[model samples]
Target: MSARLAPVDMTAFSPGRCARLIVKVGSALLVDPDGQVRRDWLKGLVADIAGRVRAGQQVAVVSSGAIALGARRLKLPKGGRASLEDAQAAAATGQIALSGVWAELLHGEGLTAAQILVTLDDLEDRRRYLNVSATLDRLLKLGVLPVINENDSVATEEIRFGDNDRLAARVASAAGADGVILLSDVDGLYDRNPTTHPDAVMIPVVEKLDARIESMADRGSASGMGSGGMVSKIEAARIATSAGAHLAIATGRIDHPLQALATTGHGTIFVASQGARARKAWLRGGLTAKGTIHIDAGAVEALRQGRSLLSAGATRVEGRFARGDLVVIAGPDGTQLARGLAEYDHVDAHRITGRRSEDLGTILGYAPRSALVHRSHMALL
Candidate 1:
């Protein structure tokens, strides 16, 4: 008997299903061998972006090329390993030129493009992460395309995200994007190195990244101009999928890459492990509890029944925690029940403990949220 084939779902790759999409363009796609920007390719990409925007889907671009562009402009040595300072200096020079080109191209498409430079620290720090998320949200709401890039000029080896692939995944997670597309030189992931093995087969869809799948990843970038390789892209897929975002790796050498990927199913699509709500729950479960709230038995039962924790049921509050901080909800016997974002600060929580929702205004002199811990922000243990 002949080998059996798996069924393919073309509709799963459609970009229309995604409310927010993040596209990562590698340096090779943006720059040529001679260190010049590929205008025609960029124009095609902009057109695709415009189409997505017209369709009411928010799109963000995480691009790489500043160092390459900067090195060319500075007349730095080519085909040789450059020092960190040299790379940083080139990035500083290239970023301005790159931003200008993006602005002009996006403007021609009747879309405003805003440049956003971020380092790993921005996403790793909770306070800074929230700020970055807020900024990106506001930009999208204001109908602007965010062109995000790593702050290579200021980032050192220790602090650098190192490649745009991982940065794009972080951006997708922070922006709550439903899909992430990595445009590369190759079409998609292969069972083996396609360049080296003539019999290597392409993987159409990856439901999960297992150890066997990881072992097949090649180490170096196919395009010399880019830093990320198959290994990095696989890592990115892990991050994106775990955060409930579908990830696709596709070739950008063609015109209108995003459109091609969506309509033709010309890539390897990694299905998200969970949906948006599950992603939020994952985040809630991952946070460190800054304080604890001891609730009554009724409240514990209510939580288990999918109800919010009200002030009336919170019998005691422990530790000093501010609003928005993650706190553990405990049963009267001190067993942890759930974790959630605190609506009230420790001072206010203490004052309103065991009080009814209607009496919150009188107790605290100002009522904000009705539930002490909103169900939407809480995750049961």
Candidate 2:
């Protein structure tokens, strides 16, 4: 399917008003040669964020570097190339140490920091996504700063996010963040590899990204310490921007990286498209459909015209899904029109087949209230 599109302009927004922020810091900036959490760095970061809090801004910290530091701590034999499993083990070790460091630093700054380990599934499932979003919102309101990391220790390859850069973007979208600054070792994205070509220019504003722009992109440096390269950052930008959040890729080695990007715009900024509600964003990013619901011509028109699904129009339920499960709604010709939580079980749906909403009660011994799947529970597919 073609990607969903939105329209946003980063230049139109000033740095201050962007209250909800997602700040991503990479592993290269967080670990020392000995594989320890850089205490001084963590302290500085907490202090910087504390200033923002005092200014009445809400921030979410998306941090990487756990695996690298963990590997160092464990003194794992330095293999030429570490497998994904090896990285996962290292992350498991490092995640605990990383959280401790953040907690200590934030405590010193008179603030509370909470660890939120997540996997790709957390962002992909509607119920889980809403649960997480609500938790983050409540934490922010209660004067807590959330430090999110990939659930590397437990996540299998299939459910993993792979890199925190993309995770940051998703988190930003989940929180409706004003801006997402990806802090990495390099200064920002350049037209070409700057190390090989000294004249490679750092393009400042990415008004739009297309095939031409993607052609200039490259995979990250082959160093094992960092998880994301430039292309991953670009990909994250695409996700965040599409979700209606501003995004920036900037140098993390700089002191006060988050503050600098917020005030000075010292990074490559990608504009955003349209902002979606938490439910819509979750539907777009997370929920996977179990089966299809074939509808009549009238049903298709009603759905496309932004109408809800009633019992009468649902000609068939193609899958065995429990009530409250996500299912696809299809037109008679077989194109998906919407996705929503099924209100009735497959058997019940069959029992009430071809009946109107008002008829459901008489047909099934209970009166129905709203559409089979309410519009609030449905998102256009």
Candidate 3:
């Protein structure tokens, strides 16, 4: 039988309806002028995030403001020019408070916040990159919202010398996310500086990145306390769109910024031309799947409805495949239904083929990251 391709409709680029999304918030919006956390504004943002979660969209947050909050707590300078050591010190001090605040805010909305810290080098390394991808995939599948941050405490570049824009883009790429919202001080990319020139015009959407688009950042477009400025955001857009993730530059200075962007479409959105699977280089390689998961009728129906292949509905596991290996998904009738990256190895998979996700922790003696196969990682045949 031949397999047909269905549109990962969102992978073509709509932030509002994307299957997986990453929202990047900057320090200026998260931290007050006096270096305190903006709890009220965050509450509204959490509400927005919770709404997205309820809608079945897996959302991750890449947040800033750790250093600013730390500086205030430690009585550091507010000039935004601290040395690397001081910055690292501040990051260490602030991360504790930042995690606490995020946990508190996310919990209010009945969401669990998992903190993930990384450096640019972590993503650049192939092995580390794959680990990040797997971890993110599991977290999203489990309904745990990830709050990513640059590991500034021991890093030489991030926070001390770079911005979260690029980091957020990298995170989006690794997570195979369809959209990224960089909530900053400005509403969107402009023809010129919006703060300095009232006559400046905002660029509603960017379909392509060209020399002209690059030039916009050169025309005095940086407008906030965070370091990346418009240049880094443009660089971020390049990285994100290249990875088939659309990126948005929008103002987060107001309350419920994500809601505003969603309802009013008040931002510059950079559209992606392809999806993470458009490359399909591996699938095209025709490597045989290492194993097969024979799912029950219920799971087959669920998969067809765009749901994941859960262990609860899997009747059998065949072949010998390791975790992260490509595996075939078959129906109870033994017909191939799809293929996807496995969340578990054959040994572990066989041990709990028909177990419930909630019972996975006790069965495996550890928390499970995902079901048998996540919808985002699966390709129906």
lDDT top scorer: 1
Give the clash count for model 2: 5
Root-mean-square deviation (CA) per prediction: 5.4, 8.5, 8.1
lDDT of 1 by residue, 1-381 (tens): 001223336566567789999999998889888889999999999999999999999999998999888988887764212777877888899899999999999999999999999999998875566567767877998899999999989998888888899999999988878999999987788888888887788788999899988988998887777778999999999999988899998889899988877777767888888666655666356567889999999999999998989999999999999877889999988999888878788999999999988888877777446588867557887
Order of candidates by TM-score, top first? 1, 3, 2
Scored against the true structure, residue 155 in model 2 reaches a CA lDDT of 85
Better of 1 and 3 by TM-score: 1
Expressed as tens digits, the lDDT of each residue in 122-233 for candidate 3 is 8876446657988898899999999999888888853232788999988987898988999987667778765677677777778899999988884232434567688889
lDDT of 2 by residue, 1-381 (tens): 001111223354434567888888888788866676777776777788888888898988998878887888777655211766776788788888888888888889888999999999998885676557667876887889999999887788899888899999989866757788887877666787776777777767786888766766768643557767888888998998887777777776767766666666666778776544433555644767776678899988888787778888988878787666788888888988888877677888777767877677788887564566656567886
- Candidate 1 residue runs with Cα over 4 Å from true position: 1-8, 78-81, 284-287, 292-318, 322-324, 328-338, 341-381
Computed on alpha carbons, the lDDT of every model, listed in order, comes to: 0.85, 0.75, 0.80
TM-scores for all candidates: the values are: 0.81, 0.71, 0.72
Candidate maximizing TM-score? 1
| TM-score of model number 1 | 0.81
> After best superposition, candidate 1 residue 328: deviation in angstroms?
4.6
Between candidates 1 and 3, name the one with more favorable lDDT: 1
List the pairs of residues colliding in candidate 1: none
Report the error of model 2 at residue 200, Å.
0.8
